[model samples]
Target: MWPGGTVRDVAGLWDVALPAEAVRVPGVSMAGFRSRTDRFVDMQVVPYPALTLFVDFGDGRVVDDAGSRWMDSGVVGLAPGGARGRGRSIDCLQVRISPLVAHAVFGAGAEFSGAMVSLEELWGREAVRTRERMWEAGSWQERFAVAREMLLRGQSEGPAVDPEVAHAWRQMVRQQGRVRVAGLAEETGWSRKRLWSRFRSQVGLTPKRAAQLVRFDHAAHRLAAGEQSASVAATSGYVDQSHLHREVRAFTGVTPNAVAQAQWLDVDDVAWGRGRAGARRLRVG
Candidate 1:
């Protein structure tokens, strides 16, 4: 047994640990990964519909193909395209927070539209301290506890989004991004222009773009699960199979078939639970 809890070790590639369900906070999910050997780590990171936070605890460094590097920890924003992580001996706690909750946890002014930022830029010295604390923890469960405490504190202290904005986002998730922005505006009792501007400022994506992203994420996962492009397109609010292909290409710079075979998505069932409604999980291969 591990110090705090038993970790599910998978084929010795990496050790994956999850928090107890009782301790799981709403709107937040996290998984801990520790490399079992010194092999080189290289993998594609598929975009998901949540704000991603990485808390690093290993000696190795992870850098993307685009020249951006995170030696310690960092945050990845919405729709960060074509970024692949390359490293060795990787160890980190990966947290996925819903944009609705993230807006409050990171504050309204935080930029996450389509960028990767060092944790220091947003959390300053606190980021370093948090990393140190997690590294010092006895086990993955302890580390998850520390991270959960931090998120709870941040969410409690941060500014909240408008209730209408939260409602719209929930609706999008509930409907798998098939809802209309104009309909959301009417439901929220706000004008289209007002809702559009507010959502952009608060969530870092326009309502329409956010809907598209949600739709894309759902479709991508479906493809990853071996569903045909035509079927996914038909059910995921796309105009046609061609539309699905184009969207997969636009968001990931790859075809739907390529996305289906992406290694990054291989762990979703274990980490996020398969077919759980509204589970926003991040995938870094």
Candidate 2:
């Protein structure tokens, strides 16, 4: 019963399965999804802390609002974290890739910020070959295995992010995005300028922006869970309710109330259980 009934609460029209050990890959997590209804569904992707990869196994199409190529079987989509887009009738295995792992697997970290590109564009013909295997897999578990192997291979061969940058990223996540950039620079033994440059180039976002995105993500979930806006603001590190309002509107293009009632948030409760993929932050060794 959203205002004016303009927003349809269709979060229940899909089944979401968390990844099991067979498909487990560090720096990433999987959420398998299958549509229960054939009707067209509107997708409002919230800003997340990890880049997303979508492997469509079903016959339905996923069309984005930005006039990007339509997504279907035989193709996969890669959207950077904090990016927003819409899809329709999506029946896909969505994987959230942590930036720490995205660099090793995808290599082009800076290019992914707020960007969306097809795997074919990023990985070339290999993308086609991989999608073929995923499409041919007899079950979701099999598909997950294929994906896990592919990621493992890429991760093994790809370059690693700088250890200091990795540590800074982890500290932000550990602190729930309340950590200061200057303190992170100090702890990493790098000058503030150097830290900012390296972090931006490797992680695809400046330290402050990354922290804000993470903070906004945490606050958004709290709002969805029926917390008062003012309380969420105070507890989540914002200046006040007004600060929270501005941040929510900046990230989601909606009012605090609208984000609270977002159907997308509602799905997290069911689609993502206790071991929410990418819920655990990465650590620097």
Candidate 3:
């Protein structure tokens, strides 16, 4: 049986929040999931895109899963699209930060670079955890304000990405052009070796590598929604279909077609070999 309260909220780079009605998974209660999804989740399972911070009342854990390659976090489970419901979950907010947002905050080199470390460590660790309960027992709006303050201050000033490199990254995405690590170095006015150094430290991966992952991320989403791989390449801007396959395989360790069938992740076995993003606890009983 589904629960009564279910709200899904999505946030984009605009800072404009979009709210969706919550879903109370029928037949199952949050009690059922208090074991798995609720445990402390700090394992890097597979590869995908996106870093997820989960706050589950059923238990208490933070899960980071990317569709292609997850954050540099260690392995815990499978894919990110897990379906286990939160029994009677209250309304909560989820924000999917775009690469641009990460770039804006962390600078060009570190945004969506596949590899990841705590944001604090990169900039010298002067930041506090944004989600610590401050007022305790208050409206969600009040809690949001406290978190926003910390987030805003964290990005006030410090190490930042070079504007030219940042601009080049976006242009490449817009054009769907080939990813060339050496060329990206020229675009950013840094030697290839130098670029990789800053890029890895700041963003967690090299520029070319990160861009390809981001591109593959979009393609996976499209394919899951029924867009064919060759077609996915055309829309996302690949020179040829095989190019898309290699890029996806390098990042995700799987081919494009495999990901489509692998889209429906469960609590246990996953389709593709995605480490973290492949595990989802669904309501099977």
Candidate 4:
């Protein structure tokens, strides 16, 4: 029998399924989602630090604010401005790939920087084939397995980012985005100029932007978890609660209080294993 799944209701509208077993891939995590009542879902896509891939297998139609519609799959890059997902009867596997792994798994990192692209554009016909295979799977476990195999294959075949760049990224994440760019460059033995250029080309965001995104993500989740904004800002490396408010507005076009109530973040602990205690262990190397 397939392992029993853990389900959580998001605002009583969607049922989220978390994998019973941890995905073994480094720098990757996934969650399966399905609508509960055939009601149309108009979900705000909160920007996060990683590259995201959404594979739809249900009979529903999914479209974004940018006017792109897809029944199969699409990729969301870092900091996609004001992206919202709209659809009915939706069922999909959402995968979040750390930019470090994305560099190898997707090959052309710069192309995805702050952009949304259909999977067809990135993987060509293989995108269709993979979606079909997942659609044919008997259970979420099977679908997750199929997706994992596809990512492993891509990682093996695609080019990798420079190790120095990878190290710098890991540092930023480890420090919760508090590490300085100059310090990272010194640690990587790359000059500041070389590090900035190479990191942007490979990771799809400048080190400073990536750090800001990471810090913002951490703060957003805390806000969602009901922490006081002032406390979060103080501990999350912000100058003040007002600074937190501004950063939240910059990223989501909303205030921190508004972000705290966003439905999209309601499932983070279950779906992404990001709880107040800590995050699920990710394979950094």
> Which prediction has the highest lDDT against the true structure?
4
What TM-score, over all chains together, does every model reach? 0.91, 0.85, 0.54, 0.89
Cα error, residue 196 of model 1, in Å, equals 0.6
Backbone clashes in each candidate structure, one number apiece? 0, 0, 47, 0
RMSD of each: 3.5, 8.3, 10.3, 5.3
* Cα lDDT, all candidates: 0.78, 0.71, 0.43, 0.79
Off by over 4 Å in 1: 59-65, 108-110, 275-285
Model 3 per-residue lDDT tens digits across residues 1-285: 112222121111011122112321111111112232222332222343333222332322333333333222111211223222222222223323334334444453443344334434444433334433522525434433443443445346545556655565565565543477777778778888877776655544556666665676667666655578889888886878998898766655677877654522222122222223434333222
Candidate 3: how large is its RMSD? 10.3
Rank the models by TM-score, top first.
Answer: 1, 4, 2, 3
TM-score of 2: 0.85
Clashing pairs in 2: none
Mark the regions of model 2 whose C-alpha exceeds 4 Å error after superposition: 1-12, 59-69, 73-89, 274-285
71: Cα error in model 2, Å? 3.1
RMSD of 1: 3.5
Model 2, 180-276: lDDT tens digits are 9999999999999999999988888899988998888888888877789999999999999999999888877788898776655656655554212
lDDT of 1 by residue, 1-285 (tens): 145654766555667788876557799988877777776666667888898888766654545547656545787788878766655666778899898888877763336676777878888999889888887888778888888888899989988889999999999989989999999999999999999988988888899988889999899889877789999999899999999998888888989998887767766766776432322233333
